[model samples]
Target: MTVKPADLLWPASTARLAIRPAVVEDLPRIFEYYRKPEVSEWLASHPADLDAFIERARQPELLACIYVVERGDIHIGDLYMGIRDAWAQKEVQAQAHATQAEIGYVIAPDYAGQGYANEAVAELLRICFEDLGLRRVTAECLAENVASWRVMEKAGMRRETVTRQASLHRSGRWLDGYGYAVLADEWRGSLVS
Candidate 1:
């Protein structure tokens, strides 16, 4: 099944957040945090300017995967969930289509350490497993980014791997990377526990 932005029930809520599809108006608030060096350092790629950010946000493909994270009227950050096919041998490849997704998030600095990331991620996992019917969901971060990995763990995703020097940072240094994942059954089990 092909997943689109419309596939998700918009304004997905956690205790303190409203996660919804990205709109043109939301891009500026998102860019506010993304433009910071501290935040941009952890991301694979970020817009260089407001215009660039808006331009990228306007794309149909990107809008489908990106979601804005908000606290009532405040824009606190953003989340991403990209659906993709899982690995399968030739004979079973069709069964793997859209069976997995990669999730990610960015919280504004002022909102860091407030459990917002954890709450938002837990909801993302719910959407991946319960709503999207994905078999598995995964996320990755630079190993040095302790907070990012911690959120994944808090959301019940297991640490799958730690690859040495797997990512090149904008600072011209190679960084170790950590991967975390959880299967649909595993996520459901986590909820029951």
Candidate 2:
């Protein structure tokens, strides 16, 4: 099945967060932290300014996958889960389309180390494997980002790979990267156990 924002039941909740589709009004709050060097430094790409951020967020495709993470009235962060084709041999390539997802999250620095990232990511995995029926979901981050990889581990995703000098940092240094993933059956089984 093709995964889209409409495929999810909005306001998906966890113990402490409400994960809902991002709206135009939420762009500023997202940009506020996303523009910061500390936050943007880890992201693959970021908007240079608020105008650029707004422009990028307005894209229909991106808006569909972007979700705002809120705690009551506080907008603390954002999440993304982009659906795509998983790898397949030529004969079975058609079966791969939209069968997997790549997820990402960014929590406000103020909310860091408070377990909010872990909580939010767990919800994201549930949304992907349960609501979206995705076969698998994966995430990657620079190896130096201890906090990010820890959240992935806390969410029950296994460390699938660690690549040396696999990514280029904005500061002109090659950085190692870590990839993590979980299959749908594995995720579901974890909940039962």
Candidate 3:
């Protein structure tokens, strides 16, 4: 058996949030965060089973890095970066390239509007394009998820389109998602003098 080092992205904010790789020890707090109705409603069709989510989120091969959003060293919410395969993501990351990594995140209702999601995403995008050598990163949010869209906007991502996709929840209904992205070349060019 072998273990690889996971990249833990750090947030850029003065608030109490400190982004780092989530550990099994953080599950209790993570559970509490996901219990928020507003935060979880748009994410899936059914309610999150806290114990199940925590157990699954801890698996290493998930290609997902769960992050703990800590404020004053207390775990507040969660931020995750799932290493999806394909520019469109269908379980084939081997088919993807440095220019087309996809990403997503969530926040507890308690932490919403406090800029935690914005800061967490900035850190992930930095790691995606810089540390991971990804050329582009995409995010998809429901058409009505204004807060999520705003987060993408604040992170410099532009919405590319809106399309219907099968919902991931009990809604059992089709949902429209707004695709957004940021390119590494563009990010680099902006930093060039």
Candidate 4:
């Protein structure tokens, strides 16, 4: 789906963390972040190779969008946004239902506890809704990981369901988890000043 101006909520604010397309120059940093225990544990990773990582990022089937989180030349973390279902975003209806583009995030352990997750996700959600014409953006996380859930809920996603033993998890066994999401309209409704 192509992004149009109407799909954007607003320009990114002064969080001072600019998120731009992941370029070849970002491979080394992204590889380092992905290799970290806190991040690698959840991801399906392979041997660390910058060339391979860059190649994978260029794959079209992935619909991957990675941004290096930077503040004053300090590379803080990486933010990834991908479209799980592009067709659904293009068919957005007024029902406030989600049928496409499941969003997820990961932050370095050292960078945790800061507001990076919130700021990064807010920007991603804005693009998904405002630019892509997406009806909703959804996310899921291990129920035991309260911080991940907090990020989703804080972004205005609802508690949709709790699936038990849905799949393998970092816990080394199947774990119950929650799914949350925010529709474009619901997100707009949430921003009452």
Q: What is the TM-score of each predicted model, taking all chains together?
A: 0.94, 0.94, 0.77, 0.78
**Candidate order by lDDT, highest to lowest?**
2, 1, 4, 3
Question: For candidate 1, lDDT tens digit of each residue in 37-132?
Answer: 779889877668899878977898887788888999999899998988999999999999889999999999988889999999999888888887
* lDDT, residue 96, candidate 3: 62
Give the residue spans of candidate 1 off by over 4 A. Answer: 1-5
Root-mean-square deviation of Cα positions for candidate 4 versus the true structure, in angstroms? 4.3
- Report the backbone clash tally of model 2: 0
lDDT of 2 by residue, 1-193 (tens): 5656585668999998999999888998898998777798898776678888889887889988789999998999999988889999999999988899899999988887799999999989988877888899999999999999999998999999999997889889999999999999999989989
In the range 1-193, model 3's lDDT, one tens digit per residue, is 0111264334434445577776787776766666667766776533367768766767875424676667776676766666544444666655563345567787777667888778778777777777777667788888778888999998888889878774444456667788898888876765563
How far does residue 193 in candidate 2 sit from its true spot (Å)?
Answer: 3.0
Candidates 1 and 4, the one with greater lDDT: 1
Clashing pairs in 3: 16-71, 45-169, 45-170, 85-92, 85-93, 98-134, 98-135, 99-135, 99-136
lDDT for model 2, on a 0 to 1 scale? Answer: 0.89
